[model samples]
Target: MALSEREQQVLRDLESQLHQEDPGLADTMDSRTTGPLRLSPRHIGAGVALVLVGMSLVVGGVVVRNSVISILLGVVGFGMAVWGVTLALTRVEAGGGPGSSRRPSRRSSFMDRQSQRWDRRRGSQG
Candidate 1:
Protein backbone atom coordinates (compact mmCIF):
# COMPACT_ATOMS: atom_id res chain seq x y z
CA MET A 1 0.00 0.00 0.00
CA ALA A 2 1.19 3.48 -0.86
CA LEU A 3 1.81 5.89 2.00
CA SER A 4 -0.53 8.87 2.21
CA GLU A 5 0.96 12.37 1.92
CA ARG A 6 0.48 12.98 5.64
CA GLU A 7 2.20 9.72 6.52
CA GLN A 8 5.05 10.53 4.16
CA GLN A 9 5.47 13.93 5.77
CA VAL A 10 5.48 12.39 9.20
CA LEU A 11 8.08 9.89 8.14
CA ARG A 12 10.26 12.60 6.67
CA ASP A 13 10.02 14.57 9.90
CA LEU A 14 10.94 11.51 11.92
CA GLU A 15 13.88 10.77 9.65
CA SER A 16 15.11 14.32 9.96
CA GLN A 17 14.83 14.16 13.73
CA LEU A 18 16.74 10.86 13.77
CA HIS A 19 19.51 12.35 11.67
CA GLN A 20 19.74 15.36 13.91
CA GLU A 21 19.79 13.27 17.08
CA ASP A 22 22.08 10.46 15.92
CA PRO A 23 23.61 10.76 12.46
CA GLY A 24 25.56 7.54 12.86
CA LEU A 25 22.45 5.58 13.71
CA ALA A 26 20.55 7.23 10.89
CA ASP A 27 23.27 6.33 8.40
CA THR A 28 23.36 2.74 9.60
CA MET A 29 19.59 2.43 9.35
CA ASP A 30 19.33 4.10 5.97
CA SER A 31 18.63 1.47 3.31
CA ARG A 32 19.05 3.91 0.39
CA THR A 33 22.84 3.99 0.78
CA THR A 34 24.97 1.36 -0.87
CA GLY A 35 27.23 -0.97 1.12
CA PRO A 36 31.04 -0.83 1.05
CA LEU A 37 31.62 -3.56 -1.49
CA ARG A 38 30.29 -3.11 -5.05
CA LEU A 39 30.93 -5.12 -8.20
CA SER A 40 32.92 -3.48 -11.02
CA PRO A 41 32.20 -4.53 -14.59
CA ARG A 42 35.64 -3.38 -15.70
CA HIS A 43 37.38 -5.52 -13.12
CA ILE A 44 35.22 -8.55 -14.00
CA GLY A 45 35.97 -8.18 -17.72
CA ALA A 46 39.71 -7.78 -17.20
CA GLY A 47 39.80 -10.73 -14.81
CA VAL A 48 37.95 -12.96 -17.25
CA ALA A 49 40.35 -11.99 -20.06
CA LEU A 50 43.35 -12.76 -17.88
CA VAL A 51 41.87 -16.15 -16.93
CA LEU A 52 41.27 -17.06 -20.57
CA VAL A 53 44.79 -16.01 -21.60
CA GLY A 54 46.25 -17.96 -18.70
CA MET A 55 44.29 -21.10 -19.65
CA SER A 56 45.45 -20.85 -23.25
CA LEU A 57 49.07 -20.51 -22.11
CA VAL A 58 48.67 -23.63 -19.97
CA VAL A 59 47.26 -25.51 -22.93
CA GLY A 60 50.08 -24.26 -25.13
CA GLY A 61 52.61 -25.43 -22.54
CA VAL A 62 51.10 -28.92 -22.59
CA VAL A 63 51.29 -29.14 -26.39
CA VAL A 64 54.95 -27.99 -26.52
CA ARG A 65 57.63 -30.73 -26.85
CA ASN A 66 60.42 -29.00 -24.83
CA SER A 67 60.26 -29.98 -21.14
CA VAL A 68 61.91 -26.88 -19.62
CA ILE A 69 59.86 -24.40 -21.67
CA SER A 70 56.68 -26.39 -21.00
CA ILE A 71 57.26 -26.26 -17.23
CA LEU A 72 57.91 -22.51 -17.31
CA LEU A 73 54.83 -21.84 -19.43
CA GLY A 74 52.66 -24.01 -17.22
CA VAL A 75 53.80 -22.21 -14.08
CA VAL A 76 53.24 -18.79 -15.62
CA GLY A 77 49.83 -19.82 -16.87
CA PHE A 78 48.81 -21.06 -13.41
CA GLY A 79 49.93 -17.81 -11.82
CA MET A 80 48.01 -15.73 -14.36
CA ALA A 81 44.86 -17.77 -13.85
CA VAL A 82 45.08 -17.38 -10.07
CA TRP A 83 45.64 -13.63 -10.37
CA GLY A 84 42.73 -13.35 -12.78
CA VAL A 85 40.39 -15.20 -10.42
CA THR A 86 41.44 -12.99 -7.53
CA LEU A 87 40.82 -9.87 -9.60
CA ALA A 88 37.43 -11.11 -10.68
CA LEU A 89 36.34 -11.85 -7.13
CA THR A 90 37.57 -8.52 -5.80
CA ARG A 91 34.98 -5.72 -5.24
CA VAL A 92 35.32 -1.94 -5.25
CA GLU A 93 34.30 0.23 -2.32
CA ALA A 94 30.98 2.12 -2.59
CA GLY A 95 31.86 5.51 -1.13
CA GLY A 96 35.06 7.50 -1.43
CA GLY A 97 37.61 4.68 -1.95
CA PRO A 98 39.51 3.23 1.00
CA GLY A 99 40.76 5.53 3.79
CA SER A 100 37.94 8.04 3.30
CA SER A 101 37.19 10.76 5.84
CA ARG A 102 33.67 9.50 6.53
CA ARG A 103 32.73 8.85 10.13
CA PRO A 104 32.32 5.26 11.32
CA SER A 105 28.68 4.13 11.31
CA ARG A 106 26.65 2.91 14.30
CA ARG A 107 27.44 -0.70 13.37
CA SER A 108 31.08 -0.34 14.32
CA SER A 109 30.20 1.61 17.45
CA PHE A 110 27.75 -1.12 18.46
CA MET A 111 30.44 -3.76 17.93
CA ASP A 112 32.88 -1.73 20.01
CA ARG A 113 30.34 -1.45 22.79
CA GLN A 114 29.81 -5.20 22.72
CA SER A 115 33.55 -5.82 22.82
CA GLN A 116 33.92 -3.54 25.78
CA ARG A 117 31.14 -5.33 27.63
CA TRP A 118 32.76 -8.70 26.88
CA ASP A 119 36.10 -7.46 28.19
CA ARG A 120 34.52 -6.16 31.40
CA ARG A 121 32.72 -9.48 31.93
CA ARG A 122 35.95 -11.40 31.37
CA GLY A 123 37.86 -9.14 33.80
CA SER A 124 35.16 -9.58 36.45
CA GLN A 125 35.13 -13.37 36.08
CA GLY A 126 38.89 -13.60 36.19
Candidate 2:
Protein backbone atom coordinates (compact mmCIF):
# COMPACT_ATOMS: atom_id res chain seq x y z
CA MET A 1 0.00 0.00 0.00
CA ALA A 2 1.19 3.51 -0.78
CA LEU A 3 2.01 5.78 2.11
CA SER A 4 -0.25 8.80 2.53
CA GLU A 5 1.25 12.24 1.94
CA ARG A 6 1.23 13.02 5.65
CA GLU A 7 2.93 9.71 6.43
CA GLN A 8 5.61 10.47 3.83
CA GLN A 9 6.30 13.84 5.37
CA VAL A 10 6.50 12.28 8.83
CA LEU A 11 8.98 9.70 7.58
CA ARG A 12 11.16 12.38 6.01
CA ASP A 13 11.11 14.36 9.24
CA LEU A 14 12.11 11.30 11.24
CA GLU A 15 14.99 10.65 8.85
CA SER A 16 16.22 14.22 9.17
CA GLN A 17 15.99 13.99 12.93
CA LEU A 18 17.95 10.77 12.85
CA HIS A 19 20.76 12.44 10.89
CA GLN A 20 20.89 15.29 13.33
CA GLU A 21 20.73 13.14 16.48
CA ASP A 22 23.37 10.48 15.62
CA PRO A 23 25.57 11.31 12.67
CA GLY A 24 27.72 8.17 13.03
CA LEU A 25 24.75 5.84 12.85
CA ALA A 26 23.49 7.83 9.89
CA ASP A 27 26.85 7.52 8.13
CA THR A 28 26.94 3.74 8.72
CA MET A 29 23.41 3.35 7.40
CA ASP A 30 24.19 5.55 4.43
CA SER A 31 27.33 3.54 3.68
CA ARG A 32 25.42 0.29 3.82
CA THR A 33 22.83 1.57 1.37
CA THR A 34 24.95 3.66 -1.00
CA GLY A 35 28.51 2.39 -0.66
CA PRO A 36 30.07 -0.37 -2.72
CA LEU A 37 30.78 -3.80 -1.26
CA ARG A 38 33.86 -3.10 0.80
CA LEU A 39 35.67 -6.41 0.91
CA SER A 40 38.04 -6.96 3.83
CA PRO A 41 41.38 -8.72 3.71
CA ARG A 42 39.76 -11.87 5.10
CA HIS A 43 37.14 -11.80 2.36
CA ILE A 44 39.82 -11.51 -0.29
CA GLY A 45 41.63 -14.40 1.33
CA ALA A 46 38.48 -16.49 1.07
CA GLY A 47 38.21 -15.61 -2.62
CA VAL A 48 41.78 -16.81 -3.15
CA ALA A 49 40.91 -20.07 -1.35
CA LEU A 50 37.89 -20.52 -3.63
CA VAL A 51 40.15 -20.08 -6.68
CA LEU A 52 42.46 -22.77 -5.35
CA VAL A 53 39.58 -25.18 -4.78
CA GLY A 54 38.34 -24.53 -8.33
CA MET A 55 41.81 -25.27 -9.70
CA SER A 56 41.95 -28.51 -7.75
CA LEU A 57 38.58 -29.50 -9.19
CA VAL A 58 39.94 -28.90 -12.67
CA VAL A 59 43.04 -30.98 -11.98
CA GLY A 60 40.95 -33.85 -10.59
CA GLY A 61 38.72 -33.74 -13.63
CA VAL A 62 41.75 -33.93 -15.89
CA VAL A 63 43.13 -36.93 -13.99
CA VAL A 64 39.84 -38.73 -14.58
CA ARG A 65 40.26 -38.08 -18.32
CA ASN A 66 36.92 -36.24 -18.60
CA SER A 67 37.39 -33.58 -21.26
CA VAL A 68 34.05 -31.86 -20.73
CA ILE A 69 34.33 -31.78 -16.95
CA SER A 70 37.98 -30.70 -17.13
CA ILE A 71 37.15 -27.83 -19.51
CA LEU A 72 34.23 -26.67 -17.39
CA LEU A 73 36.23 -26.82 -14.17
CA GLY A 74 39.15 -25.00 -15.79
CA VAL A 75 36.86 -22.23 -16.96
CA VAL A 76 35.38 -21.95 -13.46
CA GLY A 77 38.86 -21.80 -11.96
CA PHE A 78 39.88 -19.02 -14.35
CA GLY A 79 36.78 -17.01 -13.50
CA MET A 80 37.33 -17.46 -9.77
CA ALA A 81 40.96 -16.39 -10.07
CA VAL A 82 39.94 -13.26 -11.95
CA TRP A 83 37.31 -12.52 -9.33
CA GLY A 84 39.84 -12.87 -6.51
CA VAL A 85 42.22 -10.52 -8.26
CA THR A 86 39.47 -7.97 -8.70
CA LEU A 87 38.51 -8.21 -5.05
CA ALA A 88 42.12 -7.77 -4.05
CA LEU A 89 42.74 -4.68 -6.16
CA THR A 90 39.47 -2.86 -6.65
CA ARG A 91 39.04 0.53 -4.88
CA VAL A 92 35.43 1.66 -4.69
CA GLU A 93 34.42 5.10 -3.42
CA ALA A 94 31.05 6.75 -3.34
CA GLY A 95 30.61 9.56 -5.84
CA GLY A 96 31.62 12.93 -4.29
CA GLY A 97 32.18 11.26 -0.94
CA PRO A 98 35.86 12.04 -0.37
CA GLY A 99 38.83 12.92 -2.57
CA SER A 100 36.40 13.34 -5.46
CA SER A 101 37.97 16.56 -6.67
CA ARG A 102 40.75 14.78 -8.58
CA ARG A 103 40.54 15.24 -12.34
CA PRO A 104 39.66 12.30 -14.55
CA SER A 105 42.63 10.55 -16.08
CA ARG A 106 43.23 11.15 -19.79
CA ARG A 107 44.07 7.51 -20.52
CA SER A 108 41.28 5.85 -22.47
CA SER A 109 40.88 2.21 -23.39
CA PHE A 110 39.62 1.12 -26.82
CA MET A 111 36.05 0.78 -25.57
CA ASP A 112 36.24 4.08 -23.68
CA ARG A 113 37.37 5.92 -26.83
CA GLN A 114 34.57 4.36 -28.87
CA SER A 115 31.98 5.24 -26.21
CA GLN A 116 33.19 8.85 -26.07
CA ARG A 117 32.96 9.11 -29.85
CA TRP A 118 29.42 7.76 -29.82
CA ASP A 119 28.40 10.21 -27.06
CA ARG A 120 29.88 13.15 -28.99
CA ARG A 121 28.04 12.13 -32.15
CA ARG A 122 24.75 11.93 -30.25
CA GLY A 123 25.35 15.26 -28.56
CA SER A 124 26.18 17.06 -31.83
CA GLN A 125 23.07 15.65 -33.56
CA GLY A 126 20.81 16.61 -30.67
- The best candidate by TM-score is 1
Candidate 1 C-alpha lDDT tens digits along 1-126: 999999999999999999999998998777445566776777788899999999999999999999999999999999999999999888876543455535456567888999999999999999
Residue 31 of model 1: what lDDT? 47
TM-score quality measure for candidate 1: 0.49
Per-residue lDDT tens digits of candidate 2, residues 53-102? 76777677677667887788778777777776766655545333234445
Best by lDDT: 1
Evaluate residue 11 in candidate 1 and report its C-alpha lDDT on the 0 to 100 scale: 96
Model 1 residue 34 lDDT score: 55
**Stretch of 10 with least lDDT, candidate 1:** 95-104
Q: Which portions of model 2 miss their true places by more than 4 Å? A: 1-39, 92-126
Give the worst 10-residue stretch by lDDT in candidate 2: 95-104
